[model samples]
Target chain A: MRRQVMDWLEERTGLETAVNHFLYEDIPASAGWHQVMGSVALFCFMIQILTGLLLAFNYAPTPGEAHSSVRYIMTEVTGGKLIRGLHHWGASMMIVVVVSHMVQVFLWGAHKKPREATWLVGIVLLLLTLGFGLTGYLLPWDNRAYWGTVVTTQIAAKSPGLGAQIERLLGSENGVGVVTFARFYTMHVMLLPLLTTLIVGVHIYLVRRHGIAPAPNDTAPKKKFFPGQVFKDTVAIFIAFCVLFALSVFLQAPLGRLADPTDTTYVPRPEWYFLFLFQTLKFFEGPLEVVGAHILPGLAIGALAMAPFIDRGQLRKVTQRTTAWGIALLAGAAWAGLTIAAMRSTPPETDMHAGLVDAPEWQSLSPEELAGLGHFRKQNCHACHVLGEKGKAIGPDLTASATKRDAAWHIAHFKSPAEVVPGSSMPPLTLPERQLNALAAFMLQLKPGSGASLDSAPDAVVNGAMVYQQQQCGICHQANGFGMKVGPALNGLASRRKRDWVVKHFYEPQMMVPGSTMPPYRLPKQQLQDLTTYLMELPARAPSRD
Target chain B: MLAEDSETSRRRFHLGVIYTLMGTIGAALGIPAAGYLLVPGSSNRKEEWVEVTNLEKLKAGEPEEIVFRRNRKDGWKILSEKTSAWVTKKPDGQVIAFAPSCTHLGCAFHYDEKHKNFLCPCHTSTFDLEGKPLEGPAPRALDRYQMKIEGGKILLGAVVKSQES
Candidate 1:
């Protein structure tokens, strides 16, 4: 009965014949494990589609709710974390697989002649994969998403005369805003997928039209696709997918703090896959920026597309095609070297597990705790004590103190420092009831390895640190057994002078200390505050028995 | 002939491995996706006592509707939903609170001061001073909220449904 039904369907649709042709087609016996990359790429694409569809069910595209909705998927929805993780990691996996497939095809001289269309379409598909990443990146609407796209669109804006137009087309005419969100969402979920599907259809059709490229200079008999080639492809896909699943299980996709357009302190970095391009742009700044931002990338992609035509020689062997092989190898090495350099130079992402930067924890701080952190900085508490990686070690490290003391003790200490600890160097804070509670609340939360350091410090302090090094303040003033003794020692300077005196000294160096021929430094008031804050960190002198 | 036999055996082994690998991958994707798609039944949120109004505001034997905002964690959002409850201070210095909704149809019910009874406007469901059904289509007595008084403030907990009028 089933045979008759199949025969009826076959007669009507010719489906069985197509399936038989697809399953039993002759592949070159020379085709081995290396040739499995194309099928593995196809598998990665399928995984992306599956996970992407699942993610679409929960993701909201609106600016206000996008970040919160992603948080909901991670924390609230059932198995949503895993699903989103798979989708997130799956994107990177697809890029890796597609690029590997392209590399394999190029090196094997599989892109020559009849398969040239296949190779060109594959390039288009690679661009689509990258397009997917760029668009999908902004959908989360977090700080990273907002800032990264700002940088990326700015890069696009560096395209010579068409810069502004390209920038407007990529992002909103105004900036990254409501319109940009809508445009990115549309491209990520709808436009890119549709274009990719159509192009991939053409790509696969071309692949089948010209059967698998025979191994270079091979005369071995062809093998059936059903068992040998399919088996190898299946194994490759299985291993690739297992690795993807492991990553999805182990490493969560990053969702940074909510998008803060006002946050100018953020240093935006692109996803790792695009880091090579980003790193290249770093080298060509100012007038030559166009070379790194546009010309180089454009020329590289253009050269890649014209590769088959450039090396039109009939020989496919690597030894026979020395010049082409040399160029490809050199280009690949340069690209890889740039990517590695970028990875090493760029700051590690604010991953919770990375234990490097705890920006997310700052987001999770309670209102009172956040206010307390504010008071700590505003009070210049770091001048006397170390907390996390910031602050001087003049007093007790607050991280250890926080672990040892309770909130009550912290509150009492903040209120009357002398009363709480006899002969304590800390001045009586004498803050209001609310501020006292908040300061204590903030102090009690500090612990060793909290990952609060330079990034978390208010921008002024960070800028001050940079300015100090830039101005070479250490060249004259001796501090901590470093630099020259041309000026007064900086170690106990904070105890001897007030902040006002330091500011006055910067403008009129001889006024604070007579007969001191120090050069008066002219700088902006903000820079002066930064420099003062930087200098005010001198260790206080210990009490001497009178 | 021997080489052909060996090749056939190798193909058979490969076929076995392919099936096993495919099965493992299918389960890896399918299990999570199935869990993701099939949302479980809504579980109850942990009940917390929230301040409603001061005891001074509740007159003896009179039900005063106290409206307050309750902050609830709904997914990633903290939503402040405005909720109301019926509070009565007994002549004996005891306080009783009833949920604002009608026991029958979940409509907001109000105290009909003229009749000195709780009334559901939609169905004219009435309950007496102790929340016993006096008239109309209420299925049971009005639901009472677990109540406590702390520092002169009346605190209310999750609603407790009455079995009988």
Candidate 2:
């Protein structure tokens, strides 16, 4: 019945030939199978548009109600959870699609010669897609989203003369509040989507006009677009939608917690795609930091935009387009490296277990885990849990713990801490099996080694540490002398905390800390873990904390 | 030979004439278009006895709403309805209307009765009871209107956004 109706509409529109004969008649259906990710990405965007509209029905952009209104959508409105899930995952999938699309374009040298316009349009669409994600991110009014936006927009202020003005234009001069929320909301839902949609249309139109480049073959004629090309495209689209539907349904997107503007304890990080840029920002000093973070990025974009006009070359083959290909990969790789380095670089106290965690504020430490940390801290865990005199005073601080204690000893020690040592204040951790593991993970890696900070510039290390200090990262993820009582100490975080765990915590601390006094961080993952690693190195003796 | 020479001369003359006409037309049309597109059009408007509005909904001493299409660059465009703002009338029957736009540039001023003046927090520009410039670097007072009542509803027939005292 659906096919008949669709066929009727196609006939009425005279699109039967266009859809069936011109686009999809001859291409092998199976060969286009792997373009599913792109199809899923595009469908996810459509889903975002639909669900976003539904969310807009209930979402109030005013500062006071923004957070609560989103809560209402999530908990009260019909299918609000699904809508939010679609929006969040749609954003993630869009990034994935854009990356995949760019790779395809590059590997095929589609960016060369007459197709530079197509490449340029694709670049713009990618950027607008990311921009849409960035601006809309703050709309949810969650901790990571809000503060992450705040941190990202501050880079706009690095443009020297126009920086502050652009920042004010993007956000209200004061901060991300009612005006900012409304503005970001408009850009996200209206302006950005419109711009992206228009550009995406242009990208598609150009691609269709100049059909897919034929591989180096001798005899076969170019395939028409109808059933030949679009069948493949449609099949690709269907596979992609299935993956998106699976993601949206089976694994609901991560909406960790609401943002607190005043609570600076949590570190915010962007999605994985943004990790490279976040990492790239860590390589410079003060002004250089600005260039690396914001200026060069803008220039790179401007260059990409101007590519059609600049690279007056006649190359079409992928081999001939090697220079451009290298540049594209280099750009991606550079960012990835910086991000990895940034994630690995921790300042002084990346130690997860230290006396640096004072009082009742247990930050990154989970609730049941907090009970364990509290037990350890109440007895001055740092003084005793000494890893070469860096942790507690009375006991052995964890080092080579994975090797030394191994999984069995670690589990046994947590179940009976004094069993590890006679005078250990670490009491027996008696929780359900899962939480016991989380706490055990927290406990097993207590050392004062630097996290990712070892790979970063000293100044960047200092700046990240400074941000940590100003935000009072220690309030939760504590360093040595400076920090609050929420999250556990960062000293020895490198040796103890897995990089993935630290990054995840940075993405949403509450996932680690329920009933967490520590706010979820909205900083990019690279920045989050950079600061995390810095804190990991703080040994009750690190100089920065002092 | 003579016929060929004459034809060539005629072709050259036609080309010169077309080029001259094209050049002249472009000169006449292009300058103002470029200016309008690129430059901020002169925002100057003097305080004249402009019609505030003749509408029944408008009441004396109370602010009323008025809206109409504005002739912006392209053509008459539909302005946002919210841009139709509140303007307080004066004591006399000839109503004295004040633009809700703040005196320090044209941002919508929130009426702060507590402070007894309109405030623009962008640079802390303030205006007095009748939209007189009270503080800040505003060049002049908020624009006022010469209003009259007509029918049962307030009809804002004509209004201009400006900083005329």
For model 2, residues A196-260, the per-residue Cα lDDT tens digits are: 77876787677667655454342365443433333444555554555655676676454434566
Off by over 4 Å in 2: A1-41, A76-78, A216-219, A306-325, A345-546, B1-165
Candidate 1 residue lDDT tens string, A413-517? 888888988988888786677678767877766754343532275556445544554566767775544457787767567778899999999999887778888
Q: Which stretch of 10 consecutive residues in model 1 chain A shows the poorest summed lDDT?
A: A537-546
State the lDDT at A433 in candidate 1: 77
lDDT of 2: 0.57
The Cα RMSD of model 1 versus the native structure comes to 12.5
Per-model TM-score, in order, reads: 0.67, 0.46
Task: Give every collision pair in model 1.
Answer: none
Q: Write the per-residue lDDT of candidate 1 for residues B63-134, one digit (tens) a residue.
A: 888887665666655575778888889999999998889988999988888989888988998999889888
- Cα displacement (Å) at residue B83, model 1: 2.7
Best by TM-score: 1
